[model samples]
Target: MFRFLVGRLLILIPTFIGVSLLAFFPIRLLAGDPVALLSGERVMSPERHAEISHQLGLDRPYIVQYLDYLWKILHGDFGVSISQKQPVLDQFFQLFPATLELSLCAIIFAIIIGIPAGILAAVKRGSFLDQLVMGTALIGFSMPIFWWGLLLIILFSGILQWTPVSGRISLMYFFPSVTGLMLVDSLLSGEPGAFKSAVSHLILPTIVLGTIPLAIIARQTRSAMLEVLSEDYVRTARAKGLSTFRVVGVHALRNALIPVVTTIGLQVGVMLAGAILTESIFSWPGVGKWMVDSVSRRDYPVIQGGLLIIAGLVMVVNLIVDLLYGLINPRIRH
Candidate 1:
């Protein structure tokens, strides 16, 4: 296991390098210059443009710039955001926790809602409850995150006033900046009021982000359970006088979870990367919002840094999923 993990970790260097190589030149290849865009063409003179370019190291040859970027990356210097005038690493770390918190909540929400609904749907296939659960899953899968978030905000926050319309916490409650995750910080500070507000604000965004993954897990679980529940071992367990629940729950669901686990792992990365729209809608100050803001301003460092982090996360999660497959099945370890 150690050897396998080391091998996989070793491959990440080249993967990151390839990502940088592909992404670096594209900004210049595109129609506009980053410096020109930041310093508007209307008021900027030739010398000012030259200064901006020099500051960004755009005046150097592409190869030199690429080598410098790679070297700085090795030394944990993600470069300064051309627009924000802050270190890219600082900006990334500052906002990443919020997104991580949001994504964790979203995944929990997906699992709690999706897995059981799927099991029930598979257990009672062709029944009204089965149809109902599957139908809900279908709707969730079909709807867009932005649309779902809007509808939820309108119904729960706007009309009913059950939750906050936007933001991480209420203006009334004070939360410490310890963790950058408002909910955790609020709890640590023993502020139930702030925690509640943070949770309430989280509801709409989490639901919108979770919907697709929930639907996917539901469908995959249903299929997996359907297959496992009909296997010879299930019949053998039932024939040996095992309780129906034992036969299904212990024998069937345990094995069925392998595929479901894979889906969950993949969806974790997706939810993290795809939260841009949800974050924008809910005004959540997460990585997604940071990426969007950076992109709009042509902040190459932030854009590249964010994308690099996301890619690394996705690769790590995939590696975890691969290892988990062997642990769960016990068949692939050989």
Candidate 2:
């Protein structure tokens, strides 16, 4: 177990470095000159541009700038947001709960719906039910988040008027941000309908954010279940006259979870990436939308820092998943 954890931790170093390289150099290069992007509509004087560039150390060689950025990262200094003029970490922490809230809700939503659907489909393999599950999974997997969100908004928000079109909650509610999660904070406020309001606003975003992961989990779980159902242990359990639930859910599903867990783990990263679009579409005040806003404003420090922080989060989740995987199926530890 120790060895497994150590191995996973060791992998994070190079993975994080890769994330840094991808997050830094490519974005800085392909996004055009930061100074120019920051200028927006009005053309700025060349002198002002050079001054801003020098102030931002854009005047230095690209390698030097990158190394300096890495040095700052090592020192736990992600730098201040040029647009917000606040420390990146400060803003990150303040805003992270929103993203965290969205991500958690999305993943939970996925797991709750996905696992059951997968199990059902697997139990009825090669039937119409299985075909339906797989077909729906394919459609869910293929649907673009932004388009899906808009479609939901049109149907639910615009046409039906069932859910809010945008924002984390209604403007009427005000509560102390005890946990930064709207649901908790709203309950803490003891205000009427606050919790319900929070849940309502969360519904659309969660569905939109979770759709792909749900699809992936469903497919992965079904595949894993099918494989495990044919295993010797499962067959023996069935032969022993164990109940259908015990044979399938206990013997088969338990073993099948290894791959499903891996799929869920990988989905965490995808969830975060999807949150970027989901938040934008919903105008949720989370890190994803913040990152998008930062991009428009050309806040390079925020962009780089946010990317690193998000990458680090994904790494942490993956590590936890690896550890869980090892515990559940010890064969992997070897």
Clashes of each: 0, 0
Which residue segments of model 2 deviate by more than 4 Å? 31-33, 36-43
Per-residue lDDT of model 1, residues 1-334, tens digit only = 6665677678877988898887687765756577877866577889988987897788999899888988888888888888888988898889988898889898999999899999999999999999999999999899988888889999998899898899998888875599888788988888657778888888888888988999999999999999998899988998999997888788999989999999999997779766999999989998999988877778788888888778778888888897888677776655
- The top-ranked prediction according to TM-score is 2
Tens digit of per-residue lDDT, candidate 2, span 187-220: 8999998899999999999999999999999999
lDDT agreement of model 2 with the native: 0.91
* lDDT of every predicted structure (CA atoms): 0.86, 0.91
Which residue window of length 10 is worst by lDDT in model 2?
A: 25-34
lDDT of 2 at 150: 98
